[model samples]
Target: MNLQGIAAVVTGGGSGLGAATARELARRGAKVAVLDINAAAAQSVAEAIGGIACVCDITSPESVEAALARASAAHGAARVLMNVAGIGGAKRVVQRDGSAAPLEQFRRIVEVNLVGSYNVLRLAAAAMAKLDPLDDGERGVIVNTASAAAFDGQVGQAAYSASKGGVAAMTLPLARDLAQHGIRVLTIAPGLFLTPLLHELPEEVQRSLGESIPFPKRLGKPEEFAALAAHIAENAALNGEVIRIDGALRLPPR
Candidate 1:
């Protein structure tokens, strides 16, 4: 797909990898929509990229539907969808307090990470399928965000890991399902990146996390993740795979 002038929707586009991806897509001539729970942050990024800002809470069906409709009305149906809205929670199934992590907490992680991704995917895919094919019948591409923890989760990451794991496991099936419409699906499993959460950590803790990477020995950059997403979007053959961006580091047990 050329991406030029095509409509693209990026969830969690307010910051981190999603924001970087939105900017990159905009630079590549795509009509981007910045979707985030934070309207202010979404508006900031959208204004910077000359794109639309749609406030959306991925965990809510009504919120997602309205946001998708708004974006589609503004830029037309999305031919590129990026699922990047997620939350990170760390707790063992049985916490040190001799109590298990609340079921609601785990459900919330799954809701925002897994079900949220699916909500956007289904909505975007439906819209994309209605569009005419471009560049050898390729109508669109959907990129999902997972984490390296999905594959190598350490202690105290049950909820986070499970959420990401669901994302990784769904990639192939989604691709297969969407292939008939010339739509591709892919997932990215990033290692330790300097997202807002990670950046807020104490300086020493951040340094320790960076040093844990076997190579590079530093946090991954948001731009790096965005670059890979750009490559995946442009390369039609690359589908149904979870590409890991970890710096050769397998996380240690917490």
Candidate 2:
């Protein structure tokens, strides 16, 4: 996958890792589609990259179908799919007062993170399967966003961890399933990165969090994530793998 003149789709391209990915793919000569739930954010990124903006909700089949159709309408079926849309949450099973945690919170996180990712991946892969193979019999590549919390779940991250864990666990099976179609699937479980989630904190708080990384003593950059995703698209042998982009940081149970 040279990425040159090929079509690519990036979910959650409104911000954070997804935005960076959309830009990177466009820079590599891919005709990129920026899909996001936020129309404004999607349009902003899309315009900056000279790509099309398709407002999308990854959790809905119809929504995803429409988005994929729109992307294809603008720039053929995408050979690259970046499943980077997700939500995060933190909650204990039992609150301090001993009340049970709201199940809705857990369900929402899993719905938007795990189910949403699968929804997008399935639809994208189906479209990719119909495309003619490129070099090495490769049709396309998909990169999913998981998290270090999937493995090193902190005390309050039950919902978030479970959702991300599902994403990580499904990598191999999905890759194997898509292999027949010459499509590859991979996941990236990033550690603490300077995503918008952490950007709202005070400067000292952010710095404190960054210092927790064993080395480098700083938060990971979104561009670093984008770089790895581009590499995965180019390296066909890297399928069915979940690469951790954490800076040697194993989150401690809070």
Candidate 3:
């Protein structure tokens, strides 16, 4: 489980939490592969961390295969996979006009967040399974990104929440499924963080959102999320768990 010189794959590593994780992993001596839908961002981060850059579409099987191949070619088979490539959509099940929400909206969220994550995890785990076991019989570790909304979704968050909830719900079972291969799976359900999307909001809006947290009264930093993920990578006893990094902020029902 030591990250030293191990191959690691980080999807959505262009920016936000994934980018932070990639940097931290590199800092911890892991040779990282930065995969993202944004080729430029991926290249930038990879260049910054001296890692490999892979342009990948997590939703496509062919894309995932090619990306992993490139990653492996550059940095051997990955022993760590961070599934952070996801998208969010906000929509209620019904509208005020007595019309149901478009099913496509719901499907897209689940496809990117849930299905995409599973796709990368499976592929990376397979590669990890083939690696010679490290000390303590550990082959690899997977850290999946969920959201606090999965536990306490507000109004208009049905799609996003459902997608994240599926991630949270699958952690233990997936870990069990992969345990025989010496692979560990865990989920990190983060609270509001200063991701690029949220950082684009007005300063006052950002402050108000940060003030909602119970303590620290500010948005969680991307580096903080990375720190927890880095710790999980090294700690073998932490498996099949969903740890929330929300500053004790249980969202309101809105």
Residue 63 shift from truth in candidate 3, angstroms:
0.6
Please give, for residues 24-118, the per-residue lDDT of candidate 3 as tens digits. 99999999999999999999999999999999999998999999999999999999999988997788778889899999999999999999999
- Over 1-254, each residue of candidate 2 has an lDDT whose tens digit, in order, gives 79999999999999999999999999999999999999999999999999999999999999999999999999999999999999987888999999999999999999999999999999999999999998699999999999999999999899999999999999999999999999999999999999998999899999999999998799999999999999999888799999999999999987
User: 1 or 2, which is superior by lDDT?
Assistant: 2
Q: Which of the two candidates, 1 or 3, achieves a greater TM-score against the reference?
A: 3
TM-score of each: 0.97, 0.99, 0.98
Model 3 TM-score is: 0.98
Cα lDDT of model 1 by residue, 108-149, tens digit: 998999999998899889888988998589999999999999
lDDT of candidate model 3 versus the reference: 0.95
Clashing pairs in 2: none
Alpha-carbon RMSD of each model: 1.0, 0.7, 0.8
Query: Looking at candidate 3, what is the lDDT of residue 129?
Result: 91
Q: Candidate 3 clash total?
A: 0
Residue 110 displacement (Å), model 2: 0.5
